[model samples]
Target chain A: MSTIEKNVPGTRELADLVREQEEELAHLRARLAEWERTYDATPQRDALFSTSSGAEVRPLYTELDREGSDPGNDLSLPGEFPFTRGPYPTMYRTRLWTMRQFAGFATAEETNERYKYLLAHGQTGLSVAFDFPTLMGYDADHARSLGEVGVCGVAISSLDDMERLFVGIPLDQVSVSMTINGPAIILFCFYVAAAERQGISAEVLRGTVQNDILKEYQAQHAWVFPPEPALRCIIDMFEWCSENTPNYNPISISGYHIREAGSTAVQELAFTLRNGFEYVERGIARGLDVDSFAPRLSFFFDIHNDFFEEIAKLRAARRIWARRMRDVYGAKKPESWRLRTHAQTAGVSLTAQQAENNIVRVAYQAMAAALGGTQSLHTNSMDETLALPTEKAVRIALRTQQVLAFESGVTNTIDPLAGSYYVESLTDLLEREALDMFDEIDALGGVVPAIEQGWFQGEIAASAMRQQREIESGGRVVVGVNHFMEGSEKIEIDRLKIDESVERLQVARMAELRASRDSARVDQTLAALRHASSGAQNLVPAILDCARASCTLYEIRHAMEEVFGSYKEPVFF
Target chain B: MSESIRKIRVLVAKPGLDGHDRGAKVIAAAFRDAGFEVIYTGLHQTPEMIVSAAVQEDVDVVAMSVLSGAHLTLFPRVKALLDDAGADHVLLTGGGIISEDDMAALDEQGIGKLFGPGTPTTAAIDYIREWFSTHEAV
Candidate 1:
């Protein structure tokens, strides 16, 4: 009861007061309608402004919008079940999120210097970006790697390069995240061998290998083996890592590449969570307990331009994942119910024109990631839309995250925008939309079959087409490109150029490593790997043996491909 | 339709492991909207697979994309394969994260024009249409 009701001392007087307020509201509504009729609204291009995911944004929200949703029951405290507030009770209060910048270019040695530089300048962790050759499982000397080695990212052919990548930085001290998918297992083995050489055991090592082959088929298109054996390889990693490296995440189910492939936020959430569920089911099908592997599973998301929508997507993702893991999968542990994520600003949102504007774009996206309670973040450099970022550009990107951590008052409270009418409505809307998509995927017989049928690709392509059409039709105003008509912007900043000599140096290094390593031992280990691939035994240990014997990445990959066969994506209109 | 307005058949191929297909798919849709029959060879195509698909499909143009920085090697290899298979009349064009010098060198080596990242999809569509119009009798 309000103070007025207490003072009235009767139910009749309170009802009379409510009647008077209703009359006043009715008069106010009439006056507002009359004023709106007389007011000349400004001309707009469209009748309704909607989000990228097609949710219409209303001009005003009120108590009516929040009437049905119960905040006390749903919006639980941080670190509690259904972690909408956060994965931890004291999120950034205890410690700020890890500023793990993704950096690599040219060769391993050059990338090593960048890693050290980033580490010295407040970067909390490392994220390796492998070149096209390494990502596709090819040696630097392979014909397929010609003119490509050490161009887009660092090229690591053998364990020698992986060793050089973390020369001075101890692997046990800093967590590393590698962004290779198709040859992810081979790269993981190289990392393990490198750490072992550093006298760090596998049990103490911590990091994530983006061993997400499903997304490779869905969007990234960087897989070596077919889906059946590829999934088997992933399950094998899950089983092995559960026993060997307790702190390491065997797979970071990724939706960053999916969003970059032009998916909407809802699609990114639905498809990514579906992929994670498929991984869990695969582990269970392989006779592993759900709690054994689900807790170690992590997520990587792309925080895009829509600030509140991105935050709500993250929040909805956590709630849905928590409910699904507990109710459907019967997970008992709280850790299994939590969704720990690492987010990166959308590279697709960066613009080449007026490249400096990207700095502001990245800062906003980073803030959204923090507000969404990400455990780690990567801010894209301003010049990333053009090429691999130069040192200065990367530093600015890292500094963007740093400024948000230090200056932004967002960290003062967890889920600061949790109670807003707009946010709660959007979060529930996103959850319902994502659940509908999950039903559609389930009707399609699951994620793998859907991938084979090209459903995900078609959906992403259609979304991308709609966005492109909107931009071309002037319905969407991307600042530097469509709006703000000015003279042709000349690029004043220095761009990073990869000299041809970097390729030469890398090829020379490959030759030297080849000449020094024992060819017989490499052959023997590769033969064993090929033999093991034909049987039911796990290939991780065999691949690790090859890594120890100095077999290059392509060698182990080729051994498996000879048995499992290479994947060819189906065409879709 | 008039006999002079023959339907142009174009083959869009991704001949490398680079999964950046937003540009490739956009161009495919643009060509379809521009009234061309587009056969998109999906990802991870070698030079031989792409050339064989071009010859088998008898495409008028083979527009490939490789953002893996292997354009210098992949483009020349595709051009040579097309020449060897006697499908040399098929115009070969592509684009990626390539430098101006490399693009010029590839163009000089008989590959068609190379486009950078932000080039409009219509630009690619017009290039294929114009090349076929001029080389119709070849």
Candidate 2:
């Protein structure tokens, strides 16, 4: 306190006193040091040690932490051999990743309006979430589709709805990502037909359809056809897109749903990459070259609340996929060997009680996404723990991304947190763990067998149970929920409710679709689709034919059900 | 011994088009772990199909977890159909995205439990257990 006691007029007097104390302080310090040699002794065991996966704490990290494992050689340059840093040399410095948010709602017109709004609001790309019927290969107003029209997302039945969905939007410029899996090819065809009506060619079209069906069986459970045919449809799209839609990504093999389905990060990485590997294997088996399709194959992952762990996950994912594609698959082209992925912040982790706290959770999750260097990012609206996000909520969510992108100053450096002992070690550890899981998956002959045998589901279920048990027992703290529950916080949210009239209106549209379309062509398409189901022909062409003939998803699913029979899941213990 | 020999079948169906099934799936797992033979009708089950399945399976409880707010229309029809089928013993219940005032009004119509977002999995298991244990005598 006395160090600055003098006024400015007397500042020289204070400096003189400091000079006076300087000699006295040195003498006192010497005496204190001599006394400390005899008196001051404290045990030092305070250093915290832990693994990169956030498991097991210890007192220190050492050569033993490496434990006969080499830190391993990382390749130089971003787009070179094993792209541990990123998929491109000048990432985001030259151009930022496309900001793609999933958007769809009650009606085609509604979703179109939303899409135009998002594009106007600094969003660089669009991702569509079709309603259940559209996803399950059903059209609205089919008997099976009653009461469920436009419930989860927009209902796209035939070309008419597709045209309306993209009326003012240009297909040639705007890249659209569809979240449909089962009837992916047909849905893409519906988009194609709509685009053609607007005079846009396939070559000019852009974006991806998350057309990965294997992951659907393993995680999302929105599959329509059996596995082999589903794979055939996917491979056909890979062939088609590789040859035609050069600007479009054919499939986004998904691990986001797998993680959301209650898997650990390691399981998410291994299972998703393995699924991607299987697709590439299938594509190669179809006599297609690896370089042709692998460049367009993309991955999707979940960015959960674990910050460093999620970052390590992305880094490890790229390294693991790069190594496997180059050393194992012998992919000659550098693009074929890199792993480019899109990330969505964890939806399963958001809470509704103290929904405001979810904004904090999403901030950290979005930070993790950026740190992971995602090719695309979709930040979930804080209010999405309930229904589809309202426009106000969606704008806030998008703004959160913009704030992180511009103001955070995180983009000033590449991999800014790269060399922290914790981060680097965690990166190595995550890769090893995921690599071990891949070995385990390979021992079972890959993802399809693992899915069919319920191995994937079983692993996710067990992890989910453990996490739930932790939460229920108060071991985990979801603040303002179980632990800090305020019981009755006056929550008044303007919940976005779908009008009952939406269903009525949708049913009328479907009725007109049925009456106006050629009934003869519709019946013939359904019958031919049935025959294709019995035979071994790739179902994509036939499904596209049916879509072109204006047959609905429910009609085809009904006809296919009669032939392929429904799946009866074995009781997973 | 006053016969205590019935397993309370709780059919947990995920109604409508919400594919966010982690809660539904976790609840199904919890119910199963609690020794209630829970029949999960997968995702995207319609109201009519869910009610029909419960009746066909002769379940004691019909618990549908819908994060989508279609419960206003979906749950009432299930209760009405159960009444029509003379299966009043089958307690109709639902949870997810429901408010207290809405839950109270629905509870007045004999809906069993209106579990919402933070309602613990253990609490659900316990409610089902206690309710079934008490009502088996009737």
Candidate 3:
């Protein structure tokens, strides 16, 4: 045992030592006051510095911050038990964090070109952003999809589009992360089918599907099925991926959208982890071993403008998840306890005014993600607030991550801010706040129940309202927006515009595919999917069958909706 | 401003696959605070549903918000529905993520006074109040 642990100093002895330390601190304060008077100095701002979430930040930190606290076994080595510092031991030294840029717009062919461009420019992984129609599981030819086919992101309706998307890209080598939740399983099937066409085995594939459905109801509002059925679809992926594609993460429990929807960092952390725990519980209740599926589970977070607080949130996340996995869920494997995450810079923080300032903002937020020990990070482009980023803006955004990796010495140490008094204290404070929120959620009978009653939406709306009031009232300054006003100048940056012809071509292709494909086989596979969805059998293989039979995305989604029905969210303000 | 004056009844509808009602909800809350009787037809309302709601509620104004880039389809359809139903006097105005060119085309198509992201909520309130004052029903 170490000397400190062996000593176990009594309360009287500790009290005496603290008293002596206070005396010394008193003398040091007097000397500091004299020095300040000699210089006649004042700090830059008169107002107290606080975090974005309204946590008060002190001017200075000292050893006294941790005086009465004994961290005790919580402060273990990096890769050890609770993993508060990081998930891995040699964090960036072994392999740098993946610079995955989320880029997809216009058509699959166009997005394919962008993906190849990003890969050529040293991007380590691919993250896809699907267009609104595809996200809602609509084919390009659907009447509701008019004028929205390829506006926001790429449009992929069938396995043919998915095949074109990865035309030259090798499925075995690159890790792809798809940001779709509603029809995520259908998309995953398309990817698997596309890989099969390329002769890649399913077991060797690697990537993540952001199939977190509960957060859709709570925040993003991109859900297709009701919570109960949507969760069943997710558990289906968990069971299938555990056996078939061990390398791919079936679900990325996301707090990025939660924060983007106006939740504070604490709410984001609490609600996301609670969602993750709910998934684990569902998987366990489905008779799957926690250790088997838990290791492959991953997380995605939003690194907002609050630098230290964001880092603290990440640290607190790992600690809380680790403890809960081991203590609460009673998992045996170490990997089951480690909480790995991917982070993107906050999109809501990007302003339409003085867009170039967004570059500086993104860089700071990227550093915070790195310092927070993200396994992968996507830096938002400056033009995101106005429109989709042009190639130049994307290149600059990719370079930001490269600079942090190669030049900036932030990667030299693992969790460099781990022991700082402010960071540690903030980590503890955030953990306490998040736990309190978890208890409140539990009192409402857990995450799904809370979501049904609109409790989660209410909390997010309240926080969002508070934030908006602050910005409107000038209590919070948004640099060029609220202060430091500039006259309007014509924006010179080229924004990515999806051609109207792209939608026309996409609709034509979908029509041709529908006309040419074997309708009998499509009907057969879709019936199989509907049957499997209604019964207890896993739905993934049946979805894959539909993908193989050239059934379009909407066809497969409608098939399941036939059995499970669609969801209309309960409105909450 | 007499207490006996009728409140302006408005239908705030979200008519697309997009679930981003942050702006729509905020505007609805502000209109409520401004003493307007606001009927927020929540997410995924078809243009037909929106028109039927407008007729059913007898709302004076229909504020259609579409952030899903489907405004070209949805806004024109909503306007056509109001026209065919002879509720042309029911003002149809909306906004969100629509570009300058699209906004101009939509304005020419008889969708009135679309607002963007940063336009103050009070701008919407002011526009509705002014429209009600000028176009008192026959």
Candidate 4:
């Protein structure tokens, strides 16, 4: 037996024996000419070049091609340093990804029904989509929140709503992901309080809060304060999550919104990494050690329609993050190097026409995310094109994930698509492009300055415009769109219509909440909130205090705004 | 393509509480690259705010994108506001998950055409061009 193998034959010997006379490499030129004459016209094929993300495309790759590249440099084991394969060694084979489908509706009671429905339908995790009032740090009763109560998502103004939100769902078992940003600390506190009422200990609590305010200021535009205090609130959650709810993900450093903001794959990768770096810098500035809390730091990415490109982007993200944490940030712990991310199917690709078609789009996106190695996933429902997804739509979405996982045979192997020459080359290309962007951002001081100086915003605007021009000029073909003009496409679809009765019920509940709650405690809690805001203390404890005292979301935010102030966006065309 | 106007003044604004603005932002830049001045109001705007801004900006078109399923309530509110203010000249267009029948119904209310999702960025822009010319006299 040679050093290459104990008994089994090498790839070259096996390939020869298995195929034998079927081997066509020697007659490739002649076969190509005959095939071209038979099928296509062109025979010469050297004109292919780089795609937009800078991935070079050659004709083919063999076992020899794998030897010359740096494929020898071990990517560290799964769950080890620079976890390129996946964050955990066992991955979904041991425990499947948390089925964290997004849940939100009009009123607290209505949303609670949806949440219960998701739990009943085998959803392993919960993701709450708060309405604008909650996201903007305003209460339903606030003037700014007028006419906006529970429109896009569920409205939670006080602890009453939070209590009502998880009525029957056991808080201790199901891991929840709240998609709240601007006022994440307060929202997180509400969850803690709600779980406490449910007789659940904070130590046993498991969940994630999208405590990503930096991304809010940059792409999501859901900020309630200036950068400094907003960051303070974020740090408080990080510290609290570490000590209390240790299993919770404090901030899901998001590239999803940035991708949605019209950035190139490279820009999306670079900007998101820079945003994560800025968060780490913020935590370090707060006098916290990198290793102490970096383990719980997770990520959220948008899985776009570009199949291989999206897969390569996620692979490159893991490799870059692992390398950067170990080399640049001095993260010694293997957990700190692992980039565990949750992915959502691209909401941008869902078409309102033949709304059912979004099913296929979501299926492809989910597949891409799975191939890209996401730890968790949420697929947008087909009917999400119209309004909030109905139960039927959500179930179909969940089924799509099931089919990809159990039926498709894709999850049977570990990193099955790894070492593909084109994929590896693309991964390298994306990494290099992203590193170039990081270098540029580092030169400009960092993400916050880049944001304030209008550079980052300007880049998104420019990239978005370029893509739009290409699509508009007939260069890009969105099927069932501009290219293939067909008869009124059959839409056996029913749009989700929010019954007006839902609004009436919601307003009534708000009125009751206003009547039953003690006014004095709310006033005192809000006063404490204002006092805490004016000084150099974390807002989490105060926001928690306010949530406990029945202080509405608007009162808490307005109290802070009186001290911290709001943002007036820059005039950019 | 008609007259060499300064820029196709298009207000790519979102009305109501939908936080989904990626599509809106992408469309805005699409219009901007197609040589239009795009006014993108971030997220969470009232119909009154959108109408007032459209009037002050004197945009050639007011493109409202709503994903909250609040378009039925929101579109009528916007049309009412614009009508009362005598600003019907601004080509009022919308996009999101609104159905074709609903699109026809909303059109009867003077709210113009509805561009569904997956409708190419160029098609939206061309519709704006056709809309601006035919209704420019208003």
Q: Tell the DockQ for candidate 1.
A: 0.56
Model 1 C-alpha lDDT per residue in residues A324-400, reported as the tens digit of each score: 99999999999999999999999999877778888999999999999999999999999876678988999999999
Of the candidates shown, which would achieve the greatest lDDT relative to the real structure? 3
lDDT per residue as tens, model 2, A60-151: 34333343433334534566556777788777677776788899989999999999999999999999988877887777876656656787
Ordered list by TM-score, greatest first:
3, 1, 4, 2
Model 1 spans with C-alpha error above 4 angstroms: A1-48, B1-3, B80-89, B99-110, B136-138
In model 2, the clashing pairs are A49-A58, A137-A553, A138-A553, A138-A554, A139-A553
- Interface DockQ per candidate: 0.56, 0.41, 0.52, 0.44
The residue-level lDDT of candidate 4 at B60 comes to: 74
TM-score of chain B of 3: 0.94
**Per-residue CA lDDT of candidate 3, range A328-366, in tens?**
998899999999999999998987677788999999999
Instruction: Name the candidate that leads on DockQ.
Output: 1
Docking class of 2: acceptable
Model 4: per-residue Cα lDDT over B23-87, one tens digit each: 68777767877788888876678888998898998887889887666677788888889888888
Worst 10 residues of 1 chain A by lDDT: A1-10
RMSD of each: 3.9, 9.7, 3.1, 4.9
Give the residue spans of candidate 2 off by over 4 A.
Answer: A1-54, A57-72, A524-545, A555-566, A571-573, B1-7, B16-19, B32-58, B99-105
Query: Clash number for every model?
Result: 0, 5, 0, 1
Better model by lDDT: candidate 1 vs candidate 3: 3
Candidate 4 Cα errors over 4 Å, as ranges: A1-56, A62-68, A72-74, A483-488, B1-10, B23-44, B58-60, B86-88, B121-138
Q: Model 3 fnat?
A: 0.37
The count of residue-pair clashes in candidate 3 stands at: 0
